[model samples]
Target: MTDSMSDTLNNEIIVPTMAQMAAEGKQPDILFWVGCAGSFDERAQKITRDICKILQHVGISFAVLGTEESCTGDPAKRAGNEFLFQMQAMANIQVLDGYNIKKIVTGCPHCFNTIANEYPGLGGNYEVVHHSQLIQQLINEGNLKAEGGESFKGRRITFHDPCYLGRGNNVYEAPRAALEVLDADLVEMKRCKSNGLCCGAGGAQMFKEPEPGKKDINMERMNDVLEANAQVVASGCPFCMTMLSDGVKHTEKEQEIQVLDIAEITVRANGL
Candidate 1:
């Protein structure tokens, strides 16, 4: 599927929408579900571009929903509005069904968890995998290589488990496996994997202020990152990326530590 129809973004990104592919009589190998953050959040958009770069680098044909995409209704459901959530989910499922989408890959765990778990009850059933899982697959299939990993070689790095991606969905290895290829010194925080800590961005806390806590959740999570003494903290979720990056600024460790999404790291390591 080297043939693709692309609509230019600010960066000249060649991201074809499923709608465009359908009009061209072409179906992508998978649908890249760029969640709200990946679509609009400035920082998350960079991750979105890197994910696009990876997909292209590996020759995997993919397309996004673009304007036709709606929220997976994760925030609505989390905020206790089942009606709104169902409405949003059904709308998105209709779009997917229209395109006959059978597989999906997304950068946000909230979308992954919601569409993979909750959407099925609303008639949205498809093979959904997190971006990290897809990255691991690419590496295992020998399509992606960290040939330009000089930047990460011998550097201390730690992986933060997004609640929805890890504890919420029991995905504890794919991201770590992807990171292992970087040839970087990998470390673990105090709470990781199944017992991972939330970065406070979950449950729609990202759109509002925290309700009185002893310490901000990201700060506490930052403490674990600090304890790990990792020069770089790798995250999988955009919300986690935002919260942890804010945590870096809050703790004034902006100079000491760097926050990066796993997809961003993969792009760098692959020299894309």
Candidate 2:
């Protein structure tokens, strides 16, 4: 389970291909759904790697669709393009059905929400789980452990609830439970959980210019993180990470504050 990052980046990653597993007449325990951001976005790709590290360390049998994966249509649907959303959803469903995928785990909440809640109506029902939820289950099941003296130990950390994961899916405890393993001083934003503010990337706003407003929503959300005085802002969604990172930069607090995903902390704590 102990592996250097470079080793992981090279060839030690335990990820298998669904095609390979299928050809061997084997089905993986869960299909790791690397979303658009995790696949293409540079920042999110790190989170994707960390999640894979955690999964490998915990000995979870997993496989990714790789090039076969596509957009979950969360953004398209949020942008009010129902036609495009359905088109994307059905295309993805065909691939999932083709592989007979039963369980799924994603680092992006947008993908988690879309495939979990919205796909049932499109005949793509499956056990879809957010990475945080899976991590929490692993921790609770004594499969994942965070050793002491790791990074973020006794550091001030706060969690930013993503719209799709928190209020949209009511997943409030999983990320926090995952973070608690760090033994850090877990802090909460003034606006958190069900009352959390949007990071301004929701609703396809990230792809377009913002409308007239006194200040950007990410800036406003940054105000809460700053007020919380957290050294690290832990996020579960990639869009939230981008929006909050921009918010921190806009507020000139990047040097003082850091934005990280829950999986990053876990990987660090485990010394992976």
Best candidate, TM-score: 1
Record all residue pairs in model 1 with backbone atoms less than 3 Å apart, i.e. clashing. none
Q: Which digits, one per residue and each the tens of the lDDT, describe model 1 over residues 1-272?
A: 24321321132458899988999999999999999999899999999999988887777889999999988999989988999999999999999999999999999999999999998988999999999999999999998889854478899999999999999999999999989998899999989999999999888898888898798999889889999999999999999999999999998998999999999999888667
For model 2, give the 10-residue run with minimal summed lDDT: 1-10
Cα RMSD for candidates in order: 2.6, 2.3
Could you tell me the lDDT of residue 172 within candidate 1? 94
Candidate 1 weakest ten by summed lDDT: 1-10
Tell me the TM-score of model 1.
0.95
lDDT of 2 by residue, 20-107 (tens): 8888999888999999999999999999988988887776778999888889998999999999999999999999999999999999
